[model samples]
Target: MIVGLLRSLSAKVPSAVPRIALTMKPQVIFVLGGPGAGKGTQCTKIVEHYGYTHLSAGDLLRYERKRPDSEFGQLIDSYIKEGRIVPVEITINLLRKAMEKTMTENENKFRFLIDGFPRNLDNFEGWTRDMDGKADVKFVLFFDCSNEVCIDRCLERGKSSGRTDDNRESLNKRLIETFLQCTRPIIEQYERQGKVRTIDASHSVDEVFNNVKKILDKEG
Candidate 1:
């Protein structure tokens, strides 16, 4: 298993870089949000500025779904469409494999920002097992945006993305159910642990990213 590892002491660290260290296992920063909450924008900035690998769980599942020959292709696809999480074992294996590949491929380069993962209590449990029960969770970034804004963004993205699931009805379902069934408690879990940071995602793209930058800076 190729486990991707990222170290902070790489030469010529960026000015905004945090003072994290190399780890046998990569540090995970989870970015949580409702659909279309500008998680992607913040993730992009995180990668560009702070040297983190952004892993979108939705994208990963979608890619898995596209491989029709795979056994769980349709099963995984169905779960995502209903704004439901895939089975814990399946998800954990996929993420672990991906992370391992990343570690080996990047020579353990950057911290990993996992977007849309640990969508439920079970997902969290599975993740703990996958991480050998002692995973390092840096923190959670919650992109707080109104449902209306999220719907608008999903609709906008759907027009060009060839993703049928991004349509109005499906997106509405996703937004409502995602918040209710998945994100809310996870947010609270992090909050209880004092690891949740809420970001106002109602602003313009650049403005939202600026807020994210400030948070990362403070944490670093």
Candidate 2:
């Protein structure tokens, strides 16, 4: 009689469980790679194809450094030269400001293809407040290219950047330092979540953009 009662209670409790449905907030794609990994090129494709608002943190930082009296301008310049991510609070503030601008200007119709902002896990943690705990990463596109290819491209684009560190030694050091200190675990974290998408970037610019377009197309 006790066994019969126990079985009946278990059956009732199973049906009484709450029926929770999963809902995803808007998708945000972050493009990450070493310098000269064609992130800007791919960002252009995403913006053109899917109407994503492109926020290039490097460009923002570069512009800020041009102002002679800008606070943190010199520090930002030195950090970029070393291929290191800026302090978490500074980057988070910049990102938040950009996001706010995009949302207001677009009336919340904009999707973000944030380029080169979050460079470490701490940045990721800081971003949680923005999402209100309902944040879901659509994907992390890692532009996988060789250091040799990156260095070559950086040198060829000298007219635009006019940067002394665009040369072979500094470029190589940047890439090596980025790999050693930044990318490995971040890649692994996204891989564990099944949100990492990689593209072979040793191709022509058009070819790489084509690959990027294919990935962003899925969300549209």
Candidate 2 accuracy as lDDT: 0.69
The residue ranges of model 2 lying beyond 4 angstroms of the native Cα positions read 1-26, 129-136
lDDT of each: 0.75, 0.69
By TM-score, the best candidate is 1
1-220, model 1: which lDDT tens digit per residue?
0011112212222233222223556778899888899888789888999888888888888888788685567676777677666666665556666666677677655478889877878777667755653347889998999989998998899989888788888877777776656768878987999999899999999999888889999983
User: What's the residue-level lDDT of 46 in candidate 1?
Assistant: 87
How does candidate 1 score on lDDT? 0.75
Compute each candidate's TM-score over C-alphas.
0.84, 0.79
Give candidates' CA RMSD values in order.
9.9, 14.8
Give the TM-score (vs. native) of candidate 2.
0.79
Which pairs of residues clash in candidate 1, taking residues 3 or more apart in a chain or in different chains? 2-100, 4-103, 5-108, 6-108
Per-residue alpha-carbon lDDT of candidate 2 for residues 161-196, written as tens digits (9 for 90 to 100): 787668777777777766546765687788899988
